[model samples]
Target: MSHHSKAKQLLQQRDELDEKVKELLLVLETNNSTMDSPLVDAEGYPLNTIDVYAVRHARHDLICLRNDRAQWTEKIVEEMEQDEEKMGESAPIEEKPVHRTSNEPFVKVSSVVELSPADVGGFRKEDLIIQYGNLHHGNFKNMQQVAEITKEYENKTIRVTVIRDHRPVRLEISPKKWSGPGLLGCNIVPIAGANV
Candidate 1:
């Protein structure tokens, strides 16, 4: 019962304080303050009308400054990243070139032998001439102008590169006339760019 009584008393005091505050608000709202000389609170605080507005405006300015600083910091970080990339490009680091096999002009030939009637039908393109019987490559191919290379190049050991069973191989081609019969009576299609 005593606690309840104390609570009631405190509630009544709060009611009185609320009523006084309401009256003060009504007077302030109407701009009616009866004070002499300088208005001061019990705590001796001089109330300046501009103080409230100034404090609020100052807080707004602080927030804008913080936002600007954040933007500036982001810009600075972006610039730094660009600068680092530029520095790396100024003197590019040289890398060791990949070790590679020599690319000689002539294809390598592994085998040399005589040609006969049986082998003439199986010839395809990309055959390398490792051996040219006795005639050199230039002399043999250019026989169109000399006509004697065919005679000199015949019966001589010549080598060629071929692909057999999906593997690269070197074979020999000799001077042999076509003796086997074919299904189609078509004109012979000679290989192109044969250095002839």
Candidate 2:
């Protein structure tokens, strides 16, 4: 396969695997934090023993998936670099900032406060905010742009586009006054300025 196609495939696979890992981690956390062990059954039945083996099995799977994803990501970066080198040799082109593509720019979620609008909206750490309502990719030049856009739509449900685990996800977020430090209760840093 071509370098670009291969890279794209790897990226998609890595993203999917990353998402699965995250979900599995959450499941592990839930299972581990229980006050008392409870049996999980696919159908209603006499309670079966919830064993440590199930959690251990999930943990093992998560580790293997993460390791595979890391290796694939390394391959993708190498392939991308090779493609860039070939393009540069063919013609002179200005190097641009990474993550600031022609597509919608994204912001990385740096922190999220508990019980905040962001938490309610299901925003997670490392989520990439791609669009906020009408704010297109080119419309954002800095982190402040995102804050302003959210403020404008405060108390209203707004459609938000985000890149989570390398996949595009649409979420309806309503930024409003809550018992938190801010309306959204989340901190987002500009991706263009970050190492990622």
Candidate 3:
């Protein structure tokens, strides 16, 4: 996500919390007797201070929750991202490419020269179909179509149209392939405008 978009979301969340804080403050500051909702103490008389402190506690909790959200949503995303980059460089052993599950949209091909090594890892012929990437068919259609396009693209750039949950959408996935295996050894799903 872009910095501007994140800033906008944080600003909106902060504004909403501020409005809630103001509303709670107004309710606590009220001196009218009729607004009391039968709240009573040991003596059976209405407890005004009791209600005041309750609202105060709620306001305090809201403030704490907002602070926690700011710490995680604003300050933590960048730090975690940096950690990921550092980890990527300093790993102890040679890394192997990990392919997504059949349930996801990602695709991969084995290295032709190192086909045995790639095959020994995790990829399999049955694991090659492109589907919604960790998403269901109904929540959104466009991304599922992306999966279809990714599969069909194989090692060449291509466009595709797919019916996700009965809605049609178009997507284009970049051309990426394993030259060693010479076409990834998987039968790619055919989509629109494909040369078959």
CA deviation > 4 Å runs, candidate 2: 1-101, 193-196
The TM-score ranking, best first, is 2, 3, 1
Whole-model lDDT per candidate: 0.36, 0.67, 0.40
Tens-place lDDT digits, model 1, residues 68-130: 543443343334334444445332244222211211112222322223321542344334332
Quality of model 1 by C-alpha lDDT: 0.36
Point out the higher-scoring one by lDDT: 1 or 3: 3
TM-score of each: 0.22, 0.46, 0.26
Which tens-of-lDDT digit does each residue in 1-196 have in candidate 3? 3544554565566567667766655665563222334456679876756564565566566668656554444333343334444556443353332222212233322222335322333234323323322232233344345455446655553432222221223233333455444333333332332110
1-196 in candidate 2: lDDT tens per residue? 3877876888888878878888877776766623233445567552444445666667778769867865775566556656666666432244331332333445678899988998898888778776666664566666677778788879976666566664556577889999877789888787774322
Task: Answer with 2 or 3, whichever has the higher lDDT.
Answer: 2
Better of 2 and 3 by TM-score: 2
Residue 3's lDDT within candidate 1 is 42
Model 2's alpha-carbon lDDT is: 0.67
Q: Which residue runs of candidate 1 sit more than 4 Å off their true CA positions?
A: 1-118, 126-149, 162-168, 178-196
Clashing pairs in 1: 128-161, 131-158, 131-159, 133-156
